[model samples]
Each structure stands twice: as C-alpha cells, then as structure tokens.
Target: MWFSALSALWLAATAWAAVDRGEDGNIRSIALRTHTLKQPYLDSDMSSRWYDFGGDTVIRTDSYIRLSSDRPSQNGWLFSRVPLTATNWEIEVEFKISGKNQLYGDGFAMWLTKERGQLGPVFGHTNNFEGLGIFVDTYKNNRPGTVFPYVMAMVGDGKTPYNKDNDGKETEFAGCSARGIRNANIPTKLRLTYFQDKSLKLELQYKTEDEWLLCFETNEPPTIPSVTYLGFSAETGELSDNHDIISIDAKNLYTTAGSSTPSKKTPGRGGASKLAKQKEGGSWTWFFFKIIFFILAIGGGYVGWTAYRTNQKRSHRF
Candidate 1:
C-alpha cells in the first residue's frame, strides 16, 4: 500500500512538470495605449502607440482607425517595434470596413515577416494586385455583383509583377461567406494563432456587444519557423474604404523540447500587470497538495500508533 501511494505521488509530480506556463513571470516592457492619429500626440492621449504610415492617411473616428485613400496607392499600417522571436504565438484584432464607392484594392492584413520598418501597399499586393495580401476584398473582382465580401490571404516572396495586368501567383490562404454582414454594416474580429509544433490556425468572428462568433476557421500551418515583426496594413486604389482597428493582443511562447516560456504583447492596451496577479492564483494548487500531504501524514501517524498498541497488548498477554 505504501509503495502504491509513493508511485501515485511520483506520477502526479511528473504530470505537473509537463504543464506549460509560458505566460508567467515579469513583463519586460509595457507601452501606453494610444490612437495612431492623435493630434499633438500627447502622452496621455496615447492609447496604442502605432507605427503609423502616411501620417494623415488615418484618423480616429467613432472608436476606430479610419484609413482613407487620397492618392493612387495610399496605404496605412501600424506595427509594434517588439521582436516576436517566440515559436508559438497568437495575434488577434477587431476590424470594420466602412464607407461606400470603394473599389479594386486589398483590404486589411495581419502580417509576420523578417523585414523591418514599414513596407507599403505596393509590397503587399503583387504586380499591383497580389503578393502577401490577406485581402478583405470589399469590391467585386473575380466574382462580380456578389454582395458578400471575401476574406483572402495572398503570399509570395517577391518574384512577381506590380500591375493590375498581371494576376500574380500569390497564394490565397482563406475566405469567408459574404451573405449576412454587409461591407459597411457590421464589425468583425479576425484571429490568427501559431503553435510551436508548426500548426497555424485562423479564426474569424463577427463582433457583438456581448460575444463574438467563430464564423470561419482553418487548420493550415505556416511554412516559416520564426517571424521578426508583426503588424496590420490596408490599401485603396481609386475607390476608398476604411478599416478601423480597435485592439490587438498577442501572447508569444518560447519553447524548446524541454521547457516553455510565454511573453505577452498588447498594442494600444494595458494588462501585463494583471497577468502577473493571475500567476499568484496558480499557487492554490500547491497549497491544496500540501494539505493533502499533511492529512496523509496524520493518517499514517495514527495507523502507526494503532499498530504499536496492538503489539503492546499482545506482548503483555504473552
């Protein structure tokens, strides 16, 4: 019986050791949230400090970033300066496309690449139409007169043309059904998750006041192992539309064969200190285990005393 109890304890310890706790520990840095287009750009107005491109190409209106098109190849982008070296991570954002008379352009994209700083919409769409364009295509292109906007991901290394005449061979990643939500009607949330084991997952949910629905999902994984930078981008040609990005939060996990560590980066938001507080909540499990050990110790002591009493009575009788 004692041997079995010892074996159970050893198994429990082994199981506990295998659990992943990458998000624990102190944070390295936390940036104050700021709108990408705040006037005067005061430190207090900074909610999410975005790496804004096009200067006045974007505006904060009605609780989102509005990217407008005033030129032939107008583009807007915001990215964190942090390096995402972790093997596994999650990136999510809330986006809404509004306004009318928008045509012939790629929508918004969340990208992870080694290239530093901003790469404009020309680098985004290959041959002026395709490259790595995770396009929330608002206007009809391949399918004409379709009210449903399609979600597509375009990918290529470069070797492509830069004109509408060339339909570049950029790989299309995912798409959504465009029946329910109109282009200017409702907001949607898009989430992309990369696992350490080379599995990439994508999910899109329609935003609501209470909850979001998992409208689309995919199991296709990323070919690359490590991505240096992560950010969002949008482009408009003749027809103009705006993508209002509400929030973006990411949790990066550093893992090897033996150990794992998690670091979180939330752009334009604050929550790192709260995560530290939650780490303390995990200690209750250890306390519960200690209590169980104490109870077992007391029970063993009682059993030993009972055995001693029995031996003493037998000896006395003899």
Candidate 2:
C-alpha cells in the first residue's frame, strides 16, 4: 500500500513537471454549485438563490450577467451569499470584456474575501479587504516593466488599503502580464486554485479553447480569511468597457487518499485554531473517561472483596 501511494505521488509530480503548469491530471475534484453560476442565472422570482448582485449589475437570463457596460463610472458586483467552507478549492470564471473605444480603463476582480457585497474603489469592492483578490486589470495604471490587461493577486489584511494609483504594486504577492486578455477570441477565463498551507495557482484559458496557460504559482499560500465568500466585481472610470461574466464553474478539490476536512467555521472560529480546539476537547474527554474507568475498577474490586468476606462469614456459620 505504501509503495502504491508513493508511486501515485511520483506520477502526479511528473505530470506537473510538464512544460505547462496545468492542473495535475490525476487530481480529483467535484463541482460545487453553491459557488457556481451559469446561464438562466436567476430563479423563478428573478433572484439568484446562491448569489447576490449589487451596484449597476444587470442579469440577462438568456445570456450573460453584465457587470458593467461600455460606459464611464460603472461599478457592478456578484457575490456568493454563503461562505466557502472547503479546505481546498478551485474556481474557474468565464468572462468577456470588450468595447468600441481603442482606450479602456479599469477592470474586474475575483475575490475570496470575508467582506463581500460592499462597494469601493478596488474593482467595485472595498479597499483593505480581508482575503484574496485576483485582479484582471485591463488598464495600465502605473506598473513599470509590465503591460495592461494584467492578472495579479493580492492578499489583504483588513488594515492596508489598495493603492489605486500604483495598481496594487504595494501588496501584490503574485502576478503576470496577460497580453490581449481584454478581448480574446476564445473568451477569457481564469482558474484560481488554492490548497491550504500548500499552494495557490492561477491559470488563464484565453489563448485556445482547452489550453490553460499558467499565470503564477506560489508554494506558500497567503493567509486567507477563515470564512471566505466568493465574489466578482468590476469598475470602469473615464475609459470604459463592457465587462460580462458568461459562466462560472466552482469546484472543491480534494485527494481521495486522505480525508479532506471541511473548513466549517463560525464568526469567532478558524481552521487550524478550530482543529486544535477539537483536539484539546478530545483530550479532556479521554482524560475524564480514564478517571471514570479507574473509579469503576476500584468500586468493583471493593464489592468483590466485601462478597468474599461475607462468604467466609457464612461458611463459618454453616
């Protein structure tokens, strides 16, 4: 069994060693509809059950969810109502951005944040966010040695603000310049994958239909919020573009070999901290159980001794 497990790991590593930093072909995953949105997005009452929309967001049942159209000072958002409880997960977002003008400013963002459905300067969401933000920037703010329509990730700590002038140059942890990402023939899509304390990777599917090009991967994932919410937000200033989200496929990735603990969290709880608390609680339970067993054992021993004494007395009487 050990040998088989080692071989499986070796094969997965070898697959990742390929030219493209695509997903490990052997990895197992299941789609999570709680974090997914597609065509005919809204329910019968013209409201989405799993997601919430805000700002100037417009929902078209037959087509896409238009976050913002080709107009100036536009802001729109789509945020999941529930928190993502999976320990490890992947989110694939299909979207399109296009405009008649040669110039376009602002862009969109994919988020796993503690603060959702809030509006601000950071791509229709708030600054000083409490989780992960992957910005698909269409305009070049002031990034040197990089081009526009870039993809960058930032992990916010709820205190530091996003530098709109510097285009998040201050707090960005991982990023890549995705040229021609604003308007792609195959429709631009990005896949963000995160494994707790392991790795966080982003891939783009703009070049071809099925080919996913790697944007970046970091071995040490940033500190994610204990209870994260899925969200997408977009904003446009003077330069405008039509930003639309066609479909979204969210999945919870896990390995079959080991049991994947769901990251169930309350307001004051966290993942690792909660696990530690559970362990501590279990130890106390066992400690009490052992004491009870010891007491029961002594009680049985005393009862047996008393019966033996009574038997001896009865025998003498006989």
Candidate 3:
C-alpha cells in the first residue's frame, strides 16, 4: 500500500512539474489555431484554409495583407470562415497605417460579428452588425473637443444602424484616443481580449517594443454572444492611407479546451445590455499547495515503507 501510494504521488508530481511555464513562472494560455493567423499565411494553392480576403484586399506572400492601399475610394476586408467559439479569448493584431498625404481620412475596424463577408456603409463593412466592433478612427468627423485617432467599441443588436455621420458617437460605449497609432516606425499592434458575458479589454503597442498600453478595460462590458466570426476591414476616402495587417494571433484564456465555455445566450429583442460579468478574481495558491502536499505524501510513504520492511526482517529473524 505504501509503495503504491508513493508511486502515484510521484507520477502526479512529475505531471504537475512538466506544465509549460515562462521564465517568470507564469503559465501561458493555450493558442487556438482556428482563429490564429500568422506567417506562411496561405497555402501553396494561394488560398487560406481558414480565412477569406476580399474586395481591394491584396495578399503579399512575402509580407503583410494589404487591406487597403493609399488610394481613394478603396475598401477591403479579411474574415475568418469559421466562428470563434472560445468563450474567453485574446486576439493580437500587428498592423501598420501609413500614407503620403499629410491629411488622412477614414480608418479601419476589427469585428466579432454573427455574420461575415458583408460590405456596407459602416467602416466599409456592413451596418447593424450583431456583435462587437472596435473602430480605429484616424479622421476627426464631428464631436468637437475630442481627439482624433480614437478607438471606440460599439455593440449592435442587429437592428440599430451605426452612426456613421458623426463617427458612431451614438452607439459607442467604450473608447479612448490613440493618437500615435498611425505612422509608427516600430511594429504597431492591438490586442483585444474578451470574456463572453464578462469583461473586455483592448491594449495598444505602438510607442515602443513589447510595451502594451491599455486602451480600455471594463468589468461592465457590453454583453457579447458566445459564437462570432473574427474579421478585419478598412476604408480609404479622399485622403487615403495604407492599411496593412502584418499578422493576427488569437489565444484562448482560462482552461485550454473549448468545452468549458459558458452556454450560449440568446440575444435580446433589439438591445444588448451593459451588465457583463467580470472573471472572478482568484489565484493558483491552492494548486501550488496541492503539489507540495503530494510531494510530502511521497516522502512520508517512503519512510513508512522502510520502517515496515525493517520490522518484518527483525520479526523473521526472531
């Protein structure tokens, strides 16, 4: 019995120690390949198994995906063919926006919507979308006193149209000004993290290398549905800029397996509320303690087994 218990504890401890951890000892989240996009973006057949790029979008096998060039009246987009079913996930996008003209109008958007491959008025994509839209607006339209290059988030209920006239002021709920996002020398990046019916956060990496600045994080985020497609779109008007997406990497948070996600919620009649839940604050102290206790159990079992063997030998001699 002692030997069996010690053997089991030793195996359990070995498995626990083998988990992947960073130099800082933090556990890395699992990557979801279905939603992740990176180099060698397309297959040899000149097509992606997971994505579809359309309109003015040009795929450069050697480098980035040019969503829209520095020309007027250009609109382009890239969308994932399958829905991102992960309930808690983080998506990081590396991109660049550059133009020759001193004045640049229009901008790009990142979307998680129920529908995909639709072209409409809102940021060159379809209006009345059923999920989240993160608009990176470079041009200042209306709303005096606010800064340009604003990053705003809006949740649509599939009925309300985006307020394009004044730059979506009516529908936007959370946002912040990101002035240095355009024309950056270093690699510019944006990270969007969402927990379904929970929190949502956006971070920017435009100023320096590997330094992420929080654009927005909310505990009471607008309710986002569990199933949604990931997509990116950009538009260029009279004043144009080159909207290039270098890469996209998406990862799942919490437990790796998608089976642990919360059940999908049916959308309300014509509105998505602003009462999202936040991930419960906790720590892994108990997990660490469990490993420690198992190690101690193994040691105790070995000691007991040795004593039992000695007693049996002495008894046999007597």
- Top candidate, metric TM-score: 3
Which is better, 1 or 2, measured by lDDT?
Answer: 2
lDDT of 2 by residue, 146-169 (tens): 877888999999999999998989
State the lDDT at 238 in candidate 1. 67
Question: What lDDT does model 1 reach?
Answer: 0.52
Quote each prediction's TM-score.
Answer: 0.56, 0.73, 0.75
Candidate 3 lDDT (Cα, 0 to 1): 0.81
- Compared with the true structure, model 2 gives a TM-score of 0.73
The digit string of per-residue lDDT tens for model 3 on 54-80 reads 989988877999888999998999999
Q: In model 2, which range of ten residues has the least summed lDDT?
A: 17-26
Off by over 4 Å in 1: 1-52, 59-62, 69-73, 101-106, 116-133, 143-148, 160-170, 179-187, 207-220, 253-318
Clashes of each: 16, 0, 0
lDDT of each: 0.52, 0.84, 0.81
User: Which parts of model 3 have CA positions greater than 4 angstroms off?
Assistant: 1-28, 255-318
Write one digit per residue (lDDT tens) for candidate 1, span 51-98.
544432465544655454434455676655655665566666767766
